[model samples]
Target chain A: MVRVTGVADETPTVRTIRFEDPGMAAALPGQFAMVWVPGGGELPMSVMAGDPGGAAFTVRRHGPASTALYGVDRGDLIGVRGPYGNTFDVREGRLLLAGGGTGMVPMMRLAMRVADPSRVVILMGARTAPEVIFERAAAALGEVVISTDDGSRGEEGTAVDAARRLLGSGRFSAAYVCGPEPMMAGIVAEARSRGVFVQASIERPMKCGVGICGSCCMGDRLVCSDGTVFDGDRLAATGEFGAIYRDKAGIARRY
Target chain B: MGLATRVAGIDLAGPAMLASGILGISMDVFRRLLDSGAGAVVSKSLSAEPREGYPNPTMAEAAGGWLNAVGLSNPGAPNFANMMRGAPGVPVVVSLVGSDPDEFVSMARLFEGLEVPAFELNLSCPHVEKVGLEVGDDPELVSRIVRSLKGAGVRVIAKVGLGSSDYLGTVRAAEDAGADAVTAINTVRAMSIDVHSGRPVLSNGFGGLSGPPIRPIAVRCVREITSRHEIPVIGCGGVSCWEDAAEFLLAGASAVQVGTAAGGNPGIFAEINSGISSYMERRGYSEISEVRRAA
Candidate 1:
């Protein structure tokens, strides 16, 4: 169990719940925690670690689990079953992070901790203006770009638009991504086309939080243990990226 | 000699089968496990209808290994059948769980066209209610379920665990009903309480314990079952290393199933297979059958 150190409402619908966990300090971006929200339940969440933020999971308030987690405040205790899942292979180079929805959480952490903040470019996507989260915080870390589906923010189209602009311009060492399958798929393709190495974090309905239950299956890979962060090569080999995902019942569905 | 073995009349390349509900349940993962060195693999128990399953905290690290009460969450037999379409011939066993003989038999029939080697009747799930241990405790029900599946020409293996009633009777019922073989144990009924919050660790209040802690009890069950009946036995529960797998064989099991322990190191199958080969050399045994109980 860990203590909730602070809570900040990133947006109207999104909130960042912070915790004081020394163990999580070592967790790289895209790694996760099976955070048990006291009386509510446990869910796999990407742990966002930064210097000032310490460690936290950003909740978007969608389901019963997220709703309960979004309602948490300071000093409350919750159980953590991670630092689970693999981490991103961020090296010293010009890094690109493209994320949409709650996927931006980990990218923000990447921006904050990358080897060279000056060489980092972070792109965040949301549906509308108010839905745009962590804009103020992300700007503090590196070069920030925002895109919204309805054109309510910085750029109209999607994060793919901003990503295309950056990757098309010059050489990028690697790209780290998270968010909706289609969007991540687009960004991954764009990054790869430009000869930039790419890694993507994926979400699946997980039961045991540990890799054993076989719940968080994404195509052929167990998203919990094998990776929430998968390289472009791994994703391309399975042909599951931008194609299919599994639900809680182990039912395969097209993304 | 090679690490080749057979259980329930099904030829398995190795003797170690991946226990139900490890890593994700997909044809892709199954092929990976087989290629990785597992003899065969068991799917997580599927039911008549899709179950959403229990909330979080469904599993916890306990004294021996993992304690999990996943509430039998599955994609249902129909969906699983869809996934199994055009499946390659691997020694994959589909585990079925339900309330009655009809549910079990009907679910088994859904895989009729698939190359599924066998159906493992999950009569031993310790945490669920009205099924699993509940069904096993009722010898008549066990007999009917196994008999109905066997009557359909579908190979059946009844998995049994310690329950309120005599678990041996459950195995006897399966044997008398013509079950192909029996997996001798399931996770032991167990729980962990969080004194900090004064609540149970698992959301289900209690769960089945699997891993090293249950190895001794599992070996004892396999020994007792083999001693009493001529039916083949597949020992499961708490088998982490080849020594544990060999111990099960020495206790009279024809094969072994590894759970909890394999979650972290899937390569354990190859290690155990290698260990078993060297063990055969050390004992001068030629096959899995020769690694039997000592007087």
Candidate 2:
């Protein structure tokens, strides 16, 4: 169990809670943890940032689990199960990093690991400026580009439009994407057509946060264990990447 | 010189069998486990048609264990068999879950000539309604499911767990029905409630519990089954370390199936195999049966 050391409200509905755990710093770029709030249900969340001092997870207040987690005060203890799943391969050269909503959480870590931070271009999109997360931090790491549906941010269109302008440059060797399915699909399609390698972080209804639960399966892959990160070719093969996914009831909820 | 052992007439490289629910989806996952030192792998429970299972929040954390009501999600027997066409050469056991004897018979027969070595009747899934504990609770149903599968030329093992009826009685029914082996204890029926939400944690009101918390109970079940009958017992539940595996062996389990422990680390199979082998060497036992016989 880790105790909450700090909590920062990034937005009206989103909060970044920092915790003290020795193992937190060891979490890889794409691995996730099952955060269990005592008396609150456990849920999977991607680690946004971590170091020896402590680790932080940014969550949008949504469900029962998130509500309980966001409500935790400093010094409250929460159970953590992982840092599970495969890590993002940032070994390649210049990369395109695109994220939307909380998907930007892991992208920040991936940005820092790249061989050249200057070579990384980040495209983040949200409904509006208040919803944009990690803009300053992401900008400090590399060139941060933003897109909001209401044109209250960097660009007038979606994150994919920014990705399209970046991809047109043809300088990037790979594209790392994590966002709402529609945005990811748009970026993935554009990147694939350009022949750039694309690694995507996917989301699914996960239970065990380990491979045991079939809740996170996409194609033959158990997303919880096999990946939260999949390459462009692999993601394309999964029939349900952006088309369909299961809800809390395990019923196929089509997007 | 050999780490190999035989359970229910099937040769295994080691005594670590991947439990029914974990990593049972694809041949690639199975081959990965085989490479990681699993002696054999069990497929997810298969019914007549594909089951989507329960909704999200299907799993939760308990004191030292996990509670899951995954609802036996699978791609039906025929679909899974088709998917396993490319299965690597390893001893794969198919766990079948169904409501009646006929369903068991047909599903077992569907996997014929698929290189599957045996069928494990999932008569003890505590979460599912008509297919699991409900079927296992009735000794007569257990007997009929076992008999029907056995008559299909597929060697069958009955997986028994705690239910409304006596678990030992269900084991007895399987034994009388000519089951090749018995896996003692599936997950125990359990639930977790979120005090703040005042609602059940899992989408399903209840789930089956597995992990370190259930180790003692499983050990007791293994000992009871081994003591009362002459059937081969595959011990399951909460085997995280080699010592736990040794405990099950001492309790008279011919082999042990690993579940919750492997969920955290798939590489645990190799560690457990080596740990068991080293212990066997220290004890001056050339074979696993020596320890079982001593017990």
Candidate 3:
């Protein structure tokens, strides 16, 4: 069982839950942990911090489990089952971490892990300025770029649009992206067109964080096992991840 | 407590088989399910050739379940045959789907001498525009598909999805077509809309709903099908616990397939298996069939 030590609202829609599990806190960036909220059911969440004792998850209160998570206070006991999936490869050079919505959480943690803070830049996009999460904390890690869809704050457009502007001004040695599927796909497509090395975190209905249940499958690949973090080329090659996936009936549909 | 059962001469130590289309298609994930204690693993639905499937977002969650519109994506039979070599100890049920009788016959013949334990004719996929539920809705197509697979020397289980009517007709058609058993029900036709966008949540605009939300409908399907046909019934959808499994058995299913619930907890299979065993012991019953219709 994991104990919740801290809880903070990163945005009106998203919240960050900090736990006191040293083992779970030590999870690598891009890897997710399953937080079992007792009767509410277990769901996979990405680790937003490198420290195990004070691990955090930035979750959007969209569904029942997520909504219930918002009500959780400090000292709540939640069952954690992971530190699962692969981690991002942090290399030295100009690194651009771009994400939208709650996808920015892991990117925030990735920024914190870089040895040289000056080499990293975080470009985040949200629906509005109020929706931008982890901005103050992210500013301490690197240059933070914000974009909103309605022009409420920052530049107005999709996150990929913001990433494009950042890429045009300078050469980025590596790129990491996470967000809604279309947004991630757009980032991957743009990164590929520019010959930039990229890795992305993909989301699905993850049931078993350990990869046995098959709910979070993208083709034959299990996101919980093979990756939430996949190389841009690998994602393109898999054909299943970004393009098509299997439905409940074993039918394949494009996404 | 013993959770073992037999299907077509194959002995399973447990009744909780991973239904087709979950994670059973991949050999790597299939191996993991066995390690996690699944009695058997059903491979993804395969056809004569490779299928590219439909577009995304193909799945969305509703109040009590999920809806998906995956259009039967597969690597084809010949490619899948290579992966079926030297599988784990449990029975390997290869699920096959096709557009017509000839395609079904050809696909079944491809598995000839491959030593698979069973052949599940997937006549129930709800997302395809044609050749799936359309054919399934017509008993003649189901009979034709099943008849084509006859003499393949493999146990045949016809899988059918739930519908407004014709549920009993489809089951009878599979029986008439020579299916040895039947599995019911696949996802129900459903849709979810993103309120923010004022559009359907799935890219396909609609999908098949599964999980706890569909349990009652699946149970009704099992009861109706099993009561009409002598063939064994494999109850699926929303079976997350022993009580749920027991409910399926009492409703007349010989076995049960755990899907979305298993997705949430793969260990639930073993847990359900053990729970069923304990319940059986407490009730002074021996075989799972003994509890069939207990309700």
Candidate 4:
């Protein structure tokens, strides 16, 4: 069980809930944990930055599960069951990280792991200025570029648009993206054309955050087991990557 | 010396199948499951057309089991058949779910030229409407659907679960309709509510309960089926360990399907198979049939 140490409202709908979890802090970036609220429900939450003293999760209010997760009081107990799925594999090359909305949660963790900030470029986007998350935190790690759909923040337009511009600069070896499927699909196409590898953390309805429930699958791959983090080639290979995904009912829904 | 077993004329490398709905979709995943030590792999229940199951909150933890309402999601039978065209020499049992006899027959017919070893008629999905338990509960519908599939010359295994009707009656209907075998106990109808929000935890509001909590009931169902009927029974429910597999076998299940257990580790198949092998050796049994025969 992890104790809530702090909760910071990152945006109107998103909040960063901090906890004291020594074990979770050791989990690699891009992995997630299954948090169980006593009466709410167990759901997968991406693990954010953590230290030996504390760990955190960036949760966006979406449903009862998230609401229950967000309703925690400081010091309330939450059951955690992972650090599941593959983590971002850092390599010896310039890195480009692109994220949008709550998708930026894992990206923030990735940004912190890079030893050389000069080799990193962070592209973030949201619907409006207030919705933008982890701007300062991301900026502290690397060069942060912000975009909002309403033109209320730096460079109006989708984050993929700014990512395309960054890719055109021709300085990165790979790109890591987490966001809406359509936006990630766009960024993946742009990155692939630029001869850069891309790793995307795709979200699916997860049951057993460990990989058994088969709830989190993209065609043949279980997002929880095979990955919530998929490489560009893997993303391209899965027919459902940007096209469709299975919901809680195991029915395919268009992205 | 060999862990191989046959159920309703379908050969399996082991007695454990990658249960329907978990990593049962792709040809690559099927191959991987087979390689990971599954005797056979059942596909996600395929419908006539693509279905976009319930919105988020599809699964939840309920004590010792999982409650899920993944509304029989699949890319339609025609699309899945195309995927099966690339089958990699593994024993693949295609699971088909539909509301009508024609829907089930048409879906089964699509695999006429494919390498599908058998078709498991999904007549027992508890949470979905129209299809699953709804269709399964109707004896006439179950019989007609099974008869039609049998007439198609497709080997059929009827998957049954506890619903409003007597689940055994559904099994009997399938057997009378010429179903080659029976898989006992799909997830039992169940639900969970978020006390804090005062709302159903699952977006679908209801789902099938699976995992360890359902294991004893599954074993009882398998035992009951074996006791009353002379058909091959595949036991499924909360089978997470080797002991559960052994218990199911002692209760008369010819084979068992692992679902929720695989959620935590796909490698559970390998582990279960390994554990079963060790048990058999220690007990001086060479064939799984020996345990079944003794039971």
The candidate that wins on TM-score is 1
**Model 2: per-residue lDDT, tens digit, B1-295?**
4678998887778998999988666565677788899888898888888887775567877877898988888777877777676454645788999899888888877776777888888989999888789999999988887888777777888999999999999999999999999998899999988665467777788999999999999999999999999999999999999999989999999999999888747788999999989998988999988778878
- Judged by DockQ cut-offs, the docking class of candidate 2 is acceptable
**Tens-digit lDDT track of model 3 for A111-163:** 88885678888888898888888888789888888999999988999898998
Per-residue lDDT over B12-123 for candidate 3, one digit per residue giving the tens place of the 0 to 100 score: 5577788876765556566666667787778878878777555434444577666667667666887677656544443477888877888877777776667577888787
lDDT of 4 by residue, B1-295 (tens): 7799888899988999888988655576677778889888898888888766654456767887788887776777887787677554655789999988888888888887777889998888988878888888998999998888888888999999998988889989988889899998899999887655567767778888989888888998999999999888999989998889989999999999999888747688899889999989998999998878777
- When 1 and 3 are scored with TM-score, the better candidate is 1
Q: Is the docking of candidate 4 incorrect, acceptable, medium or high quality?
A: acceptable
Candidate 1 is graded, for docking, as medium
Rate residue A95 of model 2 by lDDT. 82
* Residue A20 displacement in candidate 2 (angstroms): 10
Candidate with the larger lDDT of 2 and 4:
2
Q: List per-prediction Cα lDDT, in the order shown.
A: 0.84, 0.84, 0.76, 0.83
DockQ of 4: 0.32
Off by over 4 Å in 3: A1-221, A225-255, B8-10, B86-90
Fraction of native contacts (fnat) of each candidate: 0.60, 0.23, 0.14, 0.37
Q: Looking at model 1, how many pairs of residues clash? A: 3
TM-score of each: 0.96, 0.79, 0.63, 0.80
Tens-place lDDT per residue, model 1, B149-183, is 88899889999999999999999999999999999
